[model samples]
Target: MNLYPINAGNFKLDGGAMFGVVPKSLWSRTNPADSNNMIDIAARCLLVEDGNRLILIDTGMGDKQSDKFFGYYYLWGDDTIDKSLARHGFTKDDITDVFMTHLHFDHCGGSIQWNKNKTILEPAFKNARFWSNKDHWKWATQPNRREKASFLKENILPMEESGQLKFIGLPEIDLLENSELGFDVFYANGHTDKQMIPMIRFKGKTICFMADLLPTAGHLPIPFVMGYDTRPLLTLDEKEKFLNMAADNNYYLFLEHDAHNEIITVQHTEKGVRLKEIYTCNEIFN
Candidate 1:
């Protein structure tokens, strides 16, 4: 199996929001903020090439929102799913599965698109089967007031309407032994309910797609959790346990939102789990 990094684009988010209660003095060292107090964030997705199934994880925020709506996030850069896929000599039609880590706009919006003339919304990848879990599907569809803004309907409803949406981890199992997508699935509830983190074993290495569970290397410390989390304490617990195991087993973390760092590994230090090594995707696999 081959893995590739699919960079959708970069956007700016408030450092305060991204770092939660952590002081700017601390997080700014790793993720510096601009004059407007915004930190760079990447909608970095992952592509899995195994046999005939080309699975794309997290489509990034699509370019369908109105300028006013997008103005809120400050999207930048020329990267798009099309350009990223084309870089690997592939296209939307070539994708067989879209494994969404969660239904947040930045993660799943690219799964659907506006048709010619902007008359209707449709699945962006015409031939792909979109993957989301039942719990997250409900949590996103009937989103709570706090998270309502993050879960955009335009980015989600079309997948189901198109009859291409498939649910994984239906029983809400700890680890989905066989997802039928050639990867084991684990759920992290701290960031959002039932956020499925895909654990892919490739090239004799265990690579985990860190989808908000550990957004960036700066968040390696257990206390550094996102304010957006519905349950911050739960996040602490999940991160501690996950990090301990990751350090012990030496798993390569594939970050989704880190702007500069592409991948990293953690080791148990006196201060607890800390960043061990950082690598670009090519540096580790190529």
Candidate 2:
């Protein structure tokens, strides 16, 4: 299987919310903040080319929201699925499957787009089946007050409306077998309700798509959990368990939100699990 990091775009998010209760003085060391205390973010998606199946792990926040709605996020950069796919000699139409990690806007918003007439919504990848778990689909569609803003209806709904949406069953491992996509998913609830994390085997390495579990290398210290997580304590435990396995097996963590770092590896250091090294995908695969 071949893997490519699709650069969707860059945006800024409040550093305080990202690092939870961690002091700015500490978290700022690695993830520096701008004047507004907003740290840089990348909506990096993963593209997997195996056999005839071309799969996308996630789609970044699309440009379909109203200016008033998007202004709140401070979006930046020229990256988009169309342009990024061209960089790898592909296009949105080439996609056969869109595997969403969760329905958070930033992660799955690009699944749909406005039609040419701008009269109605259409599935962005008309040919691909949009994948989401049954539980996450329900949680996002009927979102609670705490996460309502993040789970925008426009970002979803259209997939189902277009008749391309499908739900992945429980026991995450079966997803790979069922679809023949060749990657296992790790279910995490701390970040949200049953957020699926992909564990992919490629080039003699286990490359995990670190959705919100380990947002960046800075989150390696264990205490740096996100305030948005519904269950921070559960996040702590999940991180510890995942990190231990990552360290023991030397897994390559493919970060989705980290602006600078594309990939990272952690080690069981004297101070506990910490970043061992960082690398670009080319450095590891090529």
Quote the lDDT for 14 in model 2. Answer: 95
Per-residue alpha-carbon lDDT of candidate 2 for residues 76-189, written as tens digits (9 for 90 to 100): 888998999999999999999999999999999888889999989889898898998898889999999989988999889888888898887778342344445568888888
Write the residue-wise lDDT of candidate 1 on 119-156 in tens digits: 99999899999999788899999999999999999999
Question: Model 1 compared with the native: what TM-score?
Answer: 0.98
Q: What clash count goes with each model?
A: 0, 0
Question: lDDT score, residue 67, model 2?
Answer: 97
Give the runs in model 1 whose Cα sits over 4 Å from its true position: 171-173
Clashes of 1: 0
The residue pairs found clashing in candidate 2 are none
- Residue 169 displacement in candidate 2 (angstroms): 1.7
For residue 48, model 1's alpha carbon misses the true position, in angstroms, by 0.3
